[model samples]
Target: MMKKYTIENNYIKLVTIDYGAAIHQLITKDKNGNDVNVVISFEDLESYKHNPTYLGASVGRFAGRINKDGYTINGKHYSVYTKNDVHLHGGKEGFSFKTWKMESISEGENPSIKFSYSSNDMEEGYPGNLQVSVTYTIVENQLSIVFDATTDQDTIVNLTNHNYYNLSGEGSILDHELLINAESILTKDSDAIPTGKYTSVANTYFDFREKREIGSTYEFKGIDDTYVLKENNPLATIYSKKTGIEMVVTSNQPGVVIYTPETMDENKISNKPLGKYPSICFETEKFSDGPNQKDFPSTLLKKGDIYKNETYLTFNIK
Candidate 1:
């Protein structure tokens, strides 16, 4: 059995497991003071092992795809695993599939847990002996996830948490309202790889400069795009009418990848039988294919440099 841990405060409760350092549950109070499990989760570790949708796990060594199935580091070409002709979310064996060491667990004003992992040089077709640590902390009504990493050799890295959230806790998120603080999104090819260009969200379905229902426009089947963040401010906000729960997302990352799955059935998440648009993923990280796109912010980490990122998800009642 996989070891699990829990940390709580007056307003929130969080449970996490060592396997993939995945979040098992995040409990928060609703408008009527009822506990709501705002994050999509599984019943067991086995279910997480077979997870294809990356439900609630920390994803890395690169959070998004590396276009053309490979990338170059310091004048050397490196080929990585690809699906549908592009590298997707690290590779076949990503951090989301590995067990991380529980460095520490504590409860106090800031209840928190830290998980650490080391990636060997050339593992998953990437260079550098990279060491990464993810710390999840809860204080008051906020859950903060901090990712820190250092590599022994120059390499590319982008990390983000893959958390599917449904503020209502028990239904589809199609009716939820969303507000993103971005003015543009990375242009993409037919395969969902960034095309080294971007388009303004103004006058487009991509626009979310103001609050709007996720289902307001049916122009696209579902969102799976990265919005270039305008600043290091609160990047997005989500609220649910059924539960009267609100979420404010703040991150220092340059891009936020928003994905609302077209469908969520039993097969997609193992034994978990879920309906269509069950939840939405708000992945804060560097742009997709950032290493290959000269025009985008670089995700390169040097031998001695530290890569640090922080994202905060604060909960409240609308």
Candidate 2:
């Protein structure tokens, strides 16, 4: 069974569900003082259950792709669930399809809800019994997601939320201005798997160091690259001139995967069909295929050790 939980402050209203511990809605006032939902979401639980795009779900165990060869720790090789020469987002079922337990909820100036799940040993072909918790807290106009986990055996973890945001609340995101405080991005092969190398964004279309429209580049297709973040506090910012809503994204992770799909299958939001490039996602997590890349930041979670990732999205009316 699935359940929804809501928390609000003076500036925003948020809705979350136990299935996938997903974010269902985030409503904020626009410049016109009218309500708008900044995140793309479905209208019912049935649609979410078939969420091929991941939607506002929490993806985990390993958030991104791992080479089809799998990974090793302490000289022991482990095979993971994979398809088409890659292991993605834990596995076919992954954390996004799990039903988490609602642990707690609170109401106040800063309301919050916590959801937990325990992954069994070798579930999805990953070793160890892992205990994971995701807490969503609303403080004023900002929403903070904190992911914490512990494994009873040596395992790997990279958890993150997959929320598609459209600050204007409707239409394509090409008109949105974007900025990312990063100088380089992970180089990937034809299969979209990182090749353990970094490419400078200078003199390239991948550069977002300065605020600019996402469609400024010629023949703009879409973005699905991982950016190596700098030490800047706020990792990225995006704004919609139409609604005068701006979002500042901050996180403690080493990198962020920015994805802008060219099109989505027929999915409805607010009784309207979601069209092409309706939103963008900033997935803050450790480097992709970290366990396989020796130089990338490790995603290894040793026994008895805790793993934590925190990300914040602060909204304001510009």
Best by TM-score: 2
TM-score between model 2 and native: 0.97
Error of 2 at 197 (Å): 0.4
The C-alpha local distance difference test score for the whole of candidate 1 amounts to 0.87
Candidate 2, residues 178-259, lDDT tens digits: the string is 9999999999987789999999988777788999998887456788899999954799999999999999999999999999
TM-score on alpha carbons, each prediction: 0.95, 0.97
Poorest stretch of ten by lDDT in candidate 1? 265-274
**Each model's C-alpha lDDT?**
0.87, 0.90
How many Å off is the CA of 82 in candidate 2? Answer: 1.3
What would the per-residue lDDT of candidate 1 be over residues 1-318, giving only the tens digit for each residue? 678899999888999988888888999999999988888877656788887788788898999888765888888999998888888888988999999999999998889999999999998988999999999999899999999999999998999999988887856777888899999999999888999988898988678788888778756467899999996578999999988999999998999999988766544342244556788999999988888888889999999999998999999888
How far does residue 13 in candidate 1 sit from its true spot (Å)?
0.9
Superposed Cα deviation of residue 264, candidate 2 (Å):
1.8
